[model samples]
Target: MGSQAPGKGAKGPRILNVNVGVLGHVDSGKTSMVAALSTKLSTAALDKHPQSKERGITLDLGFSSFSVPLPAHLQHLPYDELQFTLVDCPGHASLIRTIIGGVQIIDMMVLVVDITKGLQTQTAECLVVGEVATSNMVVALNKCDLVPAEERPKAIRKAQKRLAQTFNLTKFAGVPMVPITAKPGGGGTGTSAAPDAEGLEELQAHLVAMVPTQPRALAAAGPLLFSIDHCFPIKGQGTVLTGTVLQGAVAVGDTIELPGLKLSKQVKSMQVFKRPVTKASQGDRVGICVTQLDPSLIERGLACAPGTVPTFNGAVAAVEKIRFYAGQVPSKAKFHVSVGHTTVMASLTFFGLPDGQGVSQEAALVQMIENLGRMALTGVPMPFDKSRDYVYQGALVIGAKFDGDIHGESCRLAFYGRLVTLINPSKPAELQQLRVYKMKEKRGVIERINEDQGNAIVRGMFKKETDPAIYTGLRVVTGRGEDGVIESSFGKSGKLKVHFAKGIQQAGRSSSDNAVILRCKRYINEHDRKRLRQ
Candidate 1:
């Protein structure tokens, strides 16, 4: 459909920037739905990943933009424009992390569902993430062309029932689900090449009715907070960063700082949806040309702001382990925490004193560490940077999604919280000692010995370490307090062998009967750990 010219004597409608993310299970037609909608306005195709072309599965986040005309009745409204940034998120379980990244910037979502498949595992995961991100939602009953005509109504009804129950507490409960056949190349075909089941025009109108355009009031007035999603170099443009401006605005020549990276750069130029603009504000998907920074240094998950970005090593937040998360999060247990597009390994401590005291007794902590019932307010150990303030004061604290089992197919969400505190750096000596102990833990276990080579065997903490310098000569202490040096790897199993510094004849314990635990010469004083709690 072509855009109608503005009525004479009236100003052309201003484009309202809105971000809508597409999510669903693999083969649920999310990308195809995006393509179907892109044709309605000036939009590029959504699936641009090379692997997407090869495997027909979206491997990463794909983006496109299009404009929808305001309804005739609403044409007189202050904002007569509906410009939407369609973020197509990957549907495969392995790529859920990418979907979480996309969710951070989107104002709302369009959940595509394959009519025949109904709700799948990843589909539910997508919804859960959307809930955690607090994004508004609309459901797209896609692939109507594939379902048999006689069975279509039943499928739609069943889906509605399931969705209603799923969204009982959500604002989108009872939200309309548009049934449409989303063809790959943009546009849809009904049974036997008929017109779209839910016409494209109707879907467009529904989108506008369902999701309100973001207000420019606070978004334009607040401090700038832009979470970068992609960065690359344009031959003449130097380095360009593309992302949705989460808050405030930035003009050309404005200086931006990335506290997490400890770097600052100047904004050489800026564009909104490819149109050169003097400035870009919140909610607009923008491309920023930066000067005095290497393109390779730019990465996703880093925030760019006009003022100082608060750096934090950790946060205090209300946490809840999903009912399905069966794994235990022992104190100091390593879990991968993903918030926005950044994932980092973090340690979790269930027993936090009102004062920074030493770790609580295991029995007491275990009793209080209930994964079910009301959400528990807990302290998570974030990466500590000693050079900056130890707390984040930003209004928006990135909430991490905890996955206790990274290798499993289960879509379990274990943790959710805002970053509040940064790792305290006041005690450098104790912190350094802790680091040495962790490094030793990563490489100090002896599995067995090779009879022919007469050497005890071991493996690197990460399964294997090709760089011998990292493990060799490292000091280690065993469970029985036996001191040793990491000699070498046994073979390929990531196990490591250590040679004891002194004889153990008096103890009379063989390597087979004994185990090892990494230790540091200077351990964190129990008193120091207690002081931190204060």
Candidate 2:
């Protein structure tokens, strides 16, 4: 069932909500545009944060929505009313985590750009985030009235051309651009004071036209997963959690679990924009009230059906490096990983199939990983299967230039991936199953050879404190093309005895400077274990 509109037993038309993210650089008029278009404001809408009003910039994600009657093309859909929930994301560079969190819930995006400034740093970053997060987007060239009347058209065209060139390498190439004056005369008290917004009607029409093309399956059958963005207390009523219903439906009196705190509470009541709703489905933005929970504990987190979400300490994912990032993505490098609304420091281990060895195997694995990534980008969940084997990559170097000037200021999005395996502390065996490895090789010269015993003492391969037992039973090759195996430690010092299967060659015995090389694969997790012990 769909959420009810604001009224008492009036039985208004069923609501179909589409979340649209407003993102751009700081002071790009994203909030102004949202304020102009939104007809209804939620409790947390329009600079609700004290710092936002004080600093004259948005410091957090703001919410406001407007409703439009269902267009004729979408009449065959399930719902009769269309609501666009505007998610105004912060544009400051420091608040990119918030923008990432907000973009996760959006069905599409309206990227606001300052007409004069064109695409700034955060604007480019927001475009990158949009490329990874959502599939559909429309650019809003805001602040058109700032330019002279005669020069407005030329300036807008120049900005559009620059934006087109920027998007040429991205998936959002050729997306529609609408010039608008979100706030005329550079200031306005509210939407009522600024009624003559340039291109407002045209922008609205473009949004409506794109609505029918959006892919939405509002089936409310899966386990309920609500992304709580705002939490507050209602005095005697209870604590209310306001967020979008990402998956499944939630009804009043049903129990939902706060996965972060590992606590479950009954849903006392629910509302959609001040209207009492008995039930709400996927894509609905609603506030749920429950008793006895402190509002301060959870500012942003996931609320879901009990036992549905699992906590993992580490995860293995199929990853591809971002082309814009110039730095090297070495394995085990730490990065800020944003999962849903939470951003945490995570050490990534990258792996893939060895080239030229497995043709069919590589094709199948790549296809599977690509499918998983596509499904995830579209907000679909595809569980990682443990039955399949994944290839291990020593490092992710594809599409990267090591010879170029790597210190340039650019987007630091090194790579993105879809989860393949989750490592839980409680399940130690899961970590043991990871077979990622790095190749290690050591070179030493054969100092002395025992012709009678058919063994040679190899030195110079390791330091004095190095353990020779680790290389025991490993194959070694000589400079003269002779193959042998490391027999055992010769003495307390770092020396090993090498034994040839067919017996030491005549060249090996005559030349004491024959070089011996040992090659072995070292697992990365084992290296981590050794470092931890140190």
Candidate 3:
């Protein structure tokens, strides 16, 4: 998707948050359903937005605020002032990148599917996007009443079956595929109550179960990462940036920098909704008045961070799964990726999966050549360590089914950034005869019946580092790069380049200790116990 103008006002911090995104294909009833569910006060922007009103389309990312009543289920939360923020994303194919940009930060999702069409291309695309972002999802079968009164049952079942295939519904299989009359015209107020069925009570219960009361793991001092959704200028106020406060807290007089800009801003004033607030926490949407800096520096994809997060020029990201919309050709071109509000344009064509890795390797993220003929930011900043990968950052268009699968200006053929093998910066396209593989298969290393290397586990480069680095283990893992590889031939000067981390050095050890490496023996014995219990 092309860039969008920043949102109104600046951003401040508020603590309690439930950030959610609405998703589906174009005309899949995402906006209308969102407007209906949001409170009367919350429905204003969505109701008045020009694109939505006149063209009947959601052009840019739209924002509205709402609070979900904690139902009988959430009375146990540790804090109050909790609320839900619903971000309405464009369901069209063109907005795929922008859709994921917002979804990356959301805690949960409400996937709206049209009951009449059942499941469309955007539905499946968005489903994969949601899965990649977060596991929690609520399926709202909008426009259910449009189906013949009797056909509603079939419509509802169709939704239920499709949902089970794509989402992790173990939390509650009986979730509400709530049949809703989601049109904005004439008395189309949304369902304030959960749908009626034996499924109704169960669905309401599941909504409470799946919708986390608060962010799962809120870091105390990782870094302040503010993803700017809206950037605008004021008469005397200078410039202000607004969006949900993604992470960390900001205070008055704190200096904030525009990501790519050399200058920063000082906080002038801050407000959350209507109330004046001081320090904001992860999730609250606040407006901050900043003094200093050029407004031009503040752009939509600009990420404001206090301390820098570790970024690699080239990285290998595992594709947990590669799925596509039925009947649509999978996007064959290399993928351009956008995560955490930053878009990296790389010509990452797909390679086969890794064969002998310990854990099942997903699709790998490789660094590709920047198609000067195709994109702007050729090099993307891929983060490392203590990172939380969102399930559906957005939708991926598989190559096989490309054409008629996408519609209108959305099906616009464009080059994309892909996660690919980082060539040794010294030599581009270094793989001469050696085949490229993203190691994603599952492998686990266990000690033999008797061996001195009792504490170590051997596996692929992709699995999480399980053993203490002190063990002097030789495990394979992905490497990062800047210079391209020179040659494919294996030789002394051309060693398969590997990076040594500070922690891996700590894994150094000569002999065993602890009476007999008791932990290993205990683990092996308990393994059989666990299997039996399962």
> What TM-score would each prediction reach against the true structure?
0.65, 0.74, 0.59
lDDT-based ranking: 2, 1, 3
Top-down TM-score ranking? 2, 1, 3
**TM-score of model 2 (CA atoms):** 0.74
lDDT of 2 at 39: 89
Regarding lDDT, does 2 or 3 come out ahead? 2
lDDT of 1 at 205: 67
After superposition, candidate 1 runs with Cα above 4 Å error:
1-13, 39-45, 70-78, 169-172, 184-199, 212-219, 323-331, 351-409, 423-534
Model 3 agreement with the true structure over 1-534: per-residue lDDT tens digits? 000112235342223457778888877766666655555232224635665566677766766655545444545654433466677888877677667777866777778777667667677667666766666777877666666777768768877787766554344244456666655232332223222312223333444566554435555344566667767777877677776655566666677655455346777766555556555666656667786646675556444454353333434333322323222212234344555555544433333333354423231223222111111112323463212222121222221123333563232223222333333322334432123332222222222111232222222312243222312223332111111111111122212222223212122233221111111111112213212110
TM-score of 3: 0.59
Of models 1 and 2, which has the larger lDDT? 2
Query: Model 1 residue 204 lDDT?
Result: 71
Model 1 lDDT per residue over 337-365, tens place: 66556665655654322213344333323
lDDT of 3 at 296: 72
